[model samples]
Target chain A: MYRQGWLGWLFVAPALLLTCVFFLWPLALVGWMSLHNWPLIGRIRWIGIANYRAMLNDPIFLQSVRFTLTYAAAITPTIFVVAMALALLANGDRRFVGLFRTLWFMPTAIGLSTASVLWVWMLNGQVGIFAAIGRALGLVETDIPYLDSGTNAMIAACSMVVWKTAGFNMVLLLVGLQSIPSELHEAARIDGAGAWQNFRHVTLPLMRRTLKLALFLSITGSLLAFDQFYIITRGGPQNGTISMVYWIYNNAFSSFRTGYAAALSLVLLAVVLLASLAQFMLFRDREDA
Target chain B: MSRNTAAWLYYAACLAVTGVFVFPVLWVLICSLRPAAESALPPAWIPSTLSLENYETLRRVGAGLWRYVGNSVAVSVGSALAVAAVAALAAFGFSRFRFAGRGVAFVLLLAAIMVPFQTVLTPLFIVLRAVGLHNTLLGLGIVYTTFHLPLAIFLMLTAMGAVPRTLDEAAMLDGAGALTVLLRVILPLVAPSLATVVLINFIAGWNEFLAALILMTDQSNYTLPVMLVTVTFGYMGTVDWGALQAATVLTMLPVLALTLCFQRYYVQGLVAGATKG
Candidate 1:
């Protein structure tokens, strides 16, 4: 290590300064903004928790929270299961495994908003592929409107999310899967363990840490989803698909309710921290058991 | 079943799965190449006729296609370079120095990774506005660099730490200064990681949508993703499917090119980050 006393401080000065100005300072400023009646272009008035109190009575915000939780509940498991399966399929150094990995992981390169726009077009009732297939298979007499109804929009958005993110988790899990020693699987096979039995007893038990990390990532990602809902549904059909981030964006930018948005941001941050804490507790308990 | 037949079946299953994922992108490419009329009709796997009308339409859309592309390229490349440069310095400091508060500062920096950007948008906006950078591309690039630092710094620290300290000590013995040693000796050793950090941050800046959308409100200042959104609602709420498809393909091109070229570094970075965390 270098003993160049204050030179070390100089090296880290830029990073520390940027982080404080952009990230840490914003965090502190948002807290202060939450306690006032700050608007887009007006004097800041101190309201002293009025925004927080108003959240209790705001129906749209409450619905947004519920709707976001529901989306997270549904999407997290879907991504996890699909990603785990892909990881298992592409785990070994087989002849075609690399090809499979690339193909699955390719979609992850596209931006979420672009992906949503593509899905919006593909799910269009009139000129969409889904409707065309449905007609070709004699499934429906006319085009199926995928984004008009709330349920359908949710389904389409979830499908898009799965397609966009499953590959990323697949890669993460693939790393974990490869870390397990191959000899353990061989021993299981020698002990007359079938594939299912080997996976159940050997793989799952060894994969707890990776699974925990992947699950946490998936949950937080789902909770913060905004672009897909904004592009696909635009919080329409009675705001059924309004996510927490989407609601926050609307209040902050669209409605120009800066103070209210700041309050909501704090609440969202608290919710995420709580979720992380819960996951940590759950994983720790399992590890101890 | 015979083992050979079982292997064949497995390959077939894998092929089918690949098709499921690749079909959407391939279909979009085909749609982009087909004539405008064919795109509006019922979907066809095979294009009866190929034309560049969609590309033509894409070029004519809001503020022109090349303008948005320029904006995206500028912002992503600028921020990626900024991230790599800043992270290199921070990594060196944290790795090579035994000064006071180094441990605490490192921990605090990594903790910034947990605070997602969504939670800080309002204040970030206000801060940018206060600094007169609210709607500028340079401002957006700086924001991207700041967000990418925590992870980049962490990764760079590990990369530099793995280098034997003896090499730098030898350089110092020969009257080499700290800056000279870092630039000439240590950086060459960590080139692979530098590439990885650049690729990760570039892809991240390219794919970012919400921040760009909220921050760049002017039509001309829109990046590719935000521009794609505007084109979707083109021509009186009726989407120009051909132009939209063409534009989407264009947006995906640079990222796909980078990933395919440096896939080893890309995957390595991801695995290292996940495992270490």
Candidate 2:
């Protein structure tokens, strides 16, 4: 019996040790550095809550806050709608379903930064395909600056994300849709229900769990968005497209204010955690009640 | 239109979407051959003249290209293998043992899924600095492994649960040790789920951007996402549209090839391993 304990520990030891040393310990260090003034090269001093206070008042940080929330707000709906539509279209019983799935899912597998850079080439104001098409179509006489200002930049960046992520979301939703017993839909149809009615009543209820999971992931992922903004906008024509995480990255990595970045990171963490937790709790309550 | 015609209309609407989605990529493929100057306006959808300059430019910058791809492959494959190994054992523990805090431990692991790495970014960086891991490939690999283990462990447990404890009993009856059962019995039965775990982790690790961006300092160490971003940002003054487009096309080929080749195996495994867990 005693020998079994030794074997168990032996089996699990390697992973435990690695995670402890690498994952847990580093996390603790992050908390410690946030309370002190630690730089990449030299100098370290503990200044309790001063960094935190600065984060609250920093105008740049606030701009990032507004931008991140707004971007998350914009992308979640856009992505989900696109994904659901794709799922429905792909889920049909057709000869070309697999081909369509592959085409749509193609963009999702490409890296977001790669897509952003690719889109940048495609959106170059002077010689981009988009500008040429726009001019030819008589939509505009001149190139409309898509990335010059925050609004158009957000539109541009969010579109890249939608293109990159929508197919993935569709696949997940497709799985959920398939899992819903067809009996539910067949019975609804027996009562002379139309396509829209079947979707509204039977389909929607069955998808609650999947929808919740997808929504939460989309919301949280969008909140932490960084790549497209970093690549496509570089915080934009005037840094208007910069999000919260980008701001943290610039401060910590670019400016070398590691301590201040750590403090700001903690703040961002608290906010995201609270928001996610609230969403999770609401779902749990709704499910039970 | 008749009711039957409406069904055709629905198909037409959705198929039109497929066309819209394919348009940009098709334009890209066509323009890739066009002369750089002639590729611009008058809105030539088809290139009158084709050239290979764009492809040549990518070959010249192969180091910068290959390094990012290498970082991506190494980090992804490494994390998937390591995370799967850890998760397999941990899953066995959770499935077989009736220990205190088992449920709580499971809950905590599930809870970890919702915790975005963003909250821990600064902390994770500081920790990397303390351990002399920052700016290193190995350091970033460690972060990827950490992020994957929770879901991996959960998936492993669900997969391992499909394994019958009777096999362990039978093996034990023959004086086989627990390690022997895991090696000879449990591990083999859970192969499907293991494939799932590996595929899922590999995909997740491949796509990981924020951690790689934050932790790695040097350009030599930059993953594809960082490299792409850096190239785009640096070249903003006088952007090389041809080279950039060629690079994007070149980068996408590998991912497309992998997905197409592994189409059946990947999604099936991912869905099975992920669904219950």
Candidate 3:
């Protein structure tokens, strides 16, 4: 590092100032707001932990917490598996590898909301292709209600997310795979190691950091999922699809219970931080082992 | 198996995977191209008719399709450029300097990554409204730029580190100031990294929904993603599938084009950001 003295601070001032004003300040404000009865437009009154206490009994909020966990639990592993398979398939330089990579990564380029909208059309009962295929396969008497039921809505939303994001994780994993020098594989081959063994011994160990990062992003993203559920399911089928963030949004905007929403937001943040911390520990523990 | 058979088998496996990823997009494109009446027919790999009626319908939405398109483009591009400039400076400082509390500041910046912005939406909305920027495109762009800083700074720092110190040192010896060296001597060498930063930010800002949905309340101020949501659920709680498909295609077009053009840098940013974390 150069000894640039105060010049260094000048260079970093804009970034630091923006972060402080936009991110850190809001973060502190959220903490403060959670302690008050802050409505969208009303007199603010300090209520201590009333919002937090109310959250424990708020049936919708509790259900949202559960549903969000269920959705994240279901989607995170699914994306990781599909992305890993794609990375393995498209990792190396072969014919049309670039074509395949681009194809897989294409959906991710589209916004999640746009992808969700497309899926909304794709899952429509009358004109949806999925329903048409279901009929052609004799799977249903007519257009299956893909979004009408809670289980099916979960499935459709999860599938749409996998389609949208798996390729991104695939690219991250592919980079990790490629960064493992080809010579290691050659050395493993010279030792008569089989493909599975080579991957297990050489690849998995070396790819741990990338795996952790990808999984961290996937889990946190799934935890905060809102647009897909909001646009496609609209927290419908009797509110079975309500996510944590969705509930927070409803409280903050729909009900104008800004303080309650702020409290819920803090809880979500705690859960996400804990989840990521757990992942970091789990990966590092494996490294030690 | 013979080598030829192995190659064909490999191709077959890849083709199958590609079908799963590509068919949805192709199907969407086909559906978007079909006449609004024909869209109700059963799924067809081939469209019997082609029309732009659905796209034309998109123009009937509030402030028209072009308005939202322009809004999204302006916000995303503006935010991307702003982020690149700010992040380039921060990366330069962090990578090239020794200063008091530098490590602490870096940690604070990275901490933003850990806290998902969704959690802070309420306070952020309040803050923006207090500052009279809640419903404005500039506020949205500022939010995007602020959130993008950590990753952009990280990527730039890595890129700047890869450039030899001797290059900048030579410029310094010629009596060039630090900012001058950064602008004239260092930035040109890291153009690819700069592109990566811009593309990443642009795609993210263009597609960002939750913040935009929360912050932008006016129909006229809606970004494309928010507008799409309104078009989907806002019309007496009914979805006009054709218009939605057409709109989706329009939204994806710029992102896909940029990704294809900048695939190398885009992929580099993804991998570098992940591995660095």
Candidate 4:
């Protein structure tokens, strides 16, 4: 193990080089761009802190942040609840559990944009299957306008996200569940613990790491969501659904305001980092307690 | 309730959940096969007239769906291979060598995992343009590989860690070079992790939207996801539901095939990458 040479560097060079060039360099450039007036097709002007200052008072940007957080807060619980239920149901060695897992996880493979397109057609006002089923079941007299209103659009987008992502969380949680030793459950039973008690004390505590990871991923994914909202609602119903990333996309690509978009991107990065750090610290403190 | 009753209830609940999760895709599949002009109003659970006309129309539609499929395949496969190659090498270095700045470098790489691709979009765009890779599939592949490298490297590090050091030592004692040991001994042992990285990268590259949309401005170079969005929305006035469904189905087919074929590895990769990372 004491033998050392330049071979290690040779092995790591390509990856480190790619990271420096593509990841770190671009990140540093984002920081630099945020301080300037970097338009798409003009001479870049070094206007220090102007983009950040403008964002402070920009109602649309503020709305985008509020909307993105609302969407993330709404969808995270929906996904986790369904995911937990799926994990519990599929935890055991039941026949066809493999099939069930496969079916559940099949949607995660579908791109969000493609899934949005499929759902858009499925939830269409006139010929959508949701409308047809609703009418057939006598749930409504006419087509259900699932994406027409602001609240309805949010609901539609959340449902699509939950469908697309819950499977992924389910798989992760299932791993957590399966990894829990059956001896622990047996010990709980020996202590006269009921099902609720067993789950509350044994299962929840044991799965904390998996739960935290899943929550972090789901929350961050929802915060950075773009494809579904962009495709399904187009931030419609008076632009009520414009997500943070979608707004950044509009500024950077559509409006050609690279500097402002870069500023927004940096703020978002900071928020995500802080949120993740907070979650990590909270979990660590809980473990310590 | 009795034990038998509880078991039955569990089975019923599982079936209900499965149906809820699988029904939308099934509905889309049926819709894709339905004739274009059909009202599809009464909810044709079973199509009266099954036709492949929509798929045919999809093939002949704007931008030619096959081109997007080819572009996606090239980009996804190219990126997955590139990431796997680079990550395997780096993971080997991190897992085995006690090199200088090893911990710092690894930490830096892991930090990139939390940095969303959006943060790097503006600068990356400028760099790609500067390098004259503005609308190239190769450029997009490189970006996908770079963005995916952190997770891939971390996962591969775990994979390589599970491999005992004795194997490397034994290989070196047998006069095998580091590359030979990595390629000959360690790699074959870590095939499962390599497969996991490749599958995950492929799915991610295939599904990546914002980057592809921003980088690949030309229609001819558009990946399937970007093309599907453009084509579906490009016809803003008259939406072709039939063709759109067909296109969506086409877009999902390869990933679905990959998932079904490698279901176990897919689950393992996902869980390890998420919970263990």
Candidate 5:
């Protein structure tokens, strides 16, 4: 055991050291900074709960919290449903399944920022492909500024996310799909279950783990969204699209409010922690039942 | 129902969905070839005057878009190497030994997954500044590696776990060094997973926006995502949508080709990380 201990430490040293130097240390340092009134280029004064309390009272920060949650609520389920649907469609044992999978999965590998850039052009009112196609096909009689309005831009951003991620999620869910034993489906079919019935009774049960993973990831990712909003809309049309993370970003890096940013981060971390714990408990309870 | 009708229905559905999935990316490619003036208002999907003008003009644009591409590659490759190396060593250690705090370490790394990066950016900023690593590739690389280490380690450890410890035991008895056994025997077995991690981490590091955005102030050092943001900046502050799209296509082309080609490894890598299979 003694020899094993040394060896383990030796092996784990690089990871532990790196994590300490990087992740845990930074996390702790940030926590410390949050407790003080930290300016970007001035003496820091300890002011417990002041930064947090200030943001807790700030209307813009409050709006950001609401907006962020609302965005996550909108995007998470939409991505999951679309991903599962794509998974079902792409999982057929056909020779062209790989082709379909790649085609679907390709968008995800494209950087979100890149996608945002491409989308701005694709959705531009005059020269844009969508507008052109819509005009040609008589789908619309007038040019619409797709990213010029908050509601419309938000929808387009969310749609871009769905398009980029559904295939990625499908690919994730595909792993879940593949790991399901085929005979379970065969057995269900023989027991007079139709396709949907088999899916509900057999597939969904086995896919629980993958579904949880996808949901958790999509939710967390959506909540932390920055690149899309930053690149696509700049949280624009009057800051209506400003997300919590983006707000925190504007505080820290843009406005140089180090203390305020740190406090917001800790609060965001707490929210994510609580949410993850709830998810874990919910899944555990389901498993127990 | 007739078999032909059913098959045709499936085909039609697949084609329609594919069209939606593929159209934007394809449109960008077509848009890139158009003359700059025509690019703004050309209604035709195919431009009347085709030119590689944007790709050629991309170099001359004050954004330093091509330099951003180079910076992206440098940071991405560096971070990927660092993450993979640290992750592999830690993963190997975890897989082989039952030791104190092992579970705690593993749990912390796993929990790090749920830690919203935005929350950590402030502290990371301070840390980088203190270490005098701010506004540098090395600083960006360190941040990316640490942020990405959890998943990469999880991927390697899972793959390493599948290689029975008996082989390690046997190799040890035969006088093989731990490093030798790891490099010679274990690494080869997990090549596919390593490749997957490489590709996944490469794409992630390449696209990572927040830290790169915050850390690097110099246009000469901008990553692709940062450069993508720069396309929005102008004298009148109006975003250049056409040039942005053209740049987007140029930046994405390599990653798109890589993922499309090595997609299978991606699936394997994801499953390895997700299920620890």
Candidate 6:
């Protein structure tokens, strides 16, 4: 297998070339663009960190950060709790568990933008099924403006994200649950442990790494959320629901501030990297203990 | 409760949860079939007269519906194949050979997985434009293949690592060249993982929004996800809910079918990718 050096290079050359051109080159260019007044068309000029300076005082940028974090906070726990429950229910070798797993995990296949469109109809005040049901059941005399206000809009977006993504987490956590040796649970039962006690002691500790990975992905995804807010709410109700990526998108595409958007993108990358690094360190230490 | 009663309760609970998860898609499917005139308030759970009229209207309204679907299929399949071939080669290299700077290169590749696409949008746009691939489907396919390489390579690496080296050595002793061994011997053994890579990459490419949005500004080249957003938002004044729902169903049909058909491998690949990352 280790016969020749050039053969290994030949095997890896295509990947390396593609990555260098697509990934590393663009990454380096992002850093370079952040320090310039790059635009869609026209002359590029060096600005020396002015874009970064402007971001500190940009209210929309700050607001987008706040909303993104708030969205992540709201959505991650919701996904985890629901996913954990779904995983437990679908864990064992029970009847019809395969069907239950498929049904629960089907939404992940649908695109985010597509899900947003479907939710728009579902949460519509006028012709939506939910609204129709509510009116028929005497819950409200009038339609509920589910996406008209900031609070309700955020809630609507969060719910759509959870609905589309919780299934993915459920599958991930199910793998973790399945990987846990049955002997641990059997031992707990031998000590007369009830369901709650066994789950609390044996299942929880064993699934720690999987839970951390799931939470990490969910939080990162929620922070980078753009399509849901963009399609569902359009950052409406006074730009209250604009996630950070959406904000960057507006700056780059709508406003044509490529340099400023590049700066914002770097800041976001830093935040995500730092947060992930912290989570990894925290989990690693706990695992060792 | 008796054991029989407890079993019944669990079954009921599982059914209820499954209903909650799947009801929205079902509702969308129903809405897609309902005629526009009857699609208004107090929506019918069961349409009085279900028809393909909404789908026809969607085709007429979104004149580019078929083109978008074609673009999506082309891009998804093209990128999936490109990623599989490139990643399999790279994974073989990493898993088999003791090359110089292999560890550093692998780590750098892994680091690319963490870098969000937003950060590279501007620069990549400029580069693609310079290369005369600004809005072409090939340009989009290349970008997708490149972006997906890291995870694809990681998954393939794991798949190849599990293969015993003796097989490769035996193949070599039988006069099979390195490329021949990779293409015939090793690849056949890891065909399942290759399929998984293709499926995962197809979904990612199919669902990709921002890249497709920025790269393919031309409507004719828009992927399904981008086209749906554009058509829905572009003609904001004349929003057709029934047609929109129909288009969404149409857009989701391929990925949904793929997932249902290959769910076992999909889940395994997803879990492997996530845990390894």
Ranked by DockQ from best down, the candidates are 1, 3, 6, 4, 5, 2
iRMSD value for model 5: 2.2
For candidate 5, the per-residue lDDT at A44 reads 91
DockQ, prediction 6: 0.73
Real A-B contacts recovered, model 2: 0.47
- Superior candidate under DockQ, 3 versus 4: 3
Better of 1 and 6 by lDDT: 1
Global CA lDDT computed for model 2? 0.76
User: Residue by residue across A1-289, what tens digits does model 2's lDDT show?
Assistant: 2134435555555556666666566556667878888787787999987888888788889889898889988999999999999999889677678888887877766777677787887777776777777888899777868876789998888888888888878888998899888899999999999999999998878888788777877877888888888877879778888888898888887888888888877778787887777776977788842
lDDT of 1 by residue, B161-191 (tens): 8999999999999999998989999999999
lDDT of 3 at B90: 93
User: Clash pairs of candidate 2?
Assistant: A30-B123
List the lowest-lDDT window of 10 residues for candidate 5 chain B: B268-277
Candidate 3, residues B1-277, lDDT tens digits: the string is 8999989988898999889888887778878898887766666778778999989988988889889999999999999999999999999988888889988999998888888899999999999998899999999999999999989998898889999999878998899888899999999999989999999899999999999999999888899998887887857566677888888888888888988888888777876766664
Q: Higher-lDDT candidate among 5 and 6?
A: 6
Per-residue alpha-carbon lDDT of candidate 4 for residues B1-277, written as tens digits (9 for 90 to 100): 9999998998898889889888888877888898888633545777888999988888877678788889999999999999999999999888877778887888888888888887788889988887788889999999999999998998998889999899888988999988899999999999999999999889989988889999998888999888788767856577777888888888888899999999888877777777654
Worst 10 residues of 2 chain B by lDDT: B268-277
TM-score, cand. 5 vs. native: 0.93
Per-prediction TM-score to the true structure, in the order listed? 0.97, 0.90, 0.94, 0.95, 0.93, 0.97
Residue pairs clashing in model 1 are: none
Candidate 3 wrongly placed segments (more than 4 Å): A1-4, A179-206, A286-289, B1-5, B234-237
Going through the candidates in order, their DockQ values are 0.74, 0.47, 0.73, 0.67, 0.65, 0.73
Q: Model 2 segments beyond 4 Å from truth?
A: A1-3, A186-192, B25-44, B48-52, B62-64, B97-111, B235-237, B268-277
- Superposed Cα deviation of residue A259, candidate 2 (Å): 1.5
Q: Each model's fnat?
A: 0.70, 0.47, 0.84, 0.70, 0.75, 0.72
Point out the higher-scoring one by lDDT: 2 or 4: 4
Provide the overall lDDT of each model, using Cα atoms, as 2-decimal numbers.
Answer: 0.88, 0.76, 0.89, 0.87, 0.80, 0.87
Fnat measured on candidate 3: 0.84
Q: What TM-score does prediction 1 earn? A: 0.97
What's the TM-score of chain A alone for every prediction?
0.95, 0.94, 0.91, 0.93, 0.91, 0.95
Clash list (residue pairs), candidate 6: none
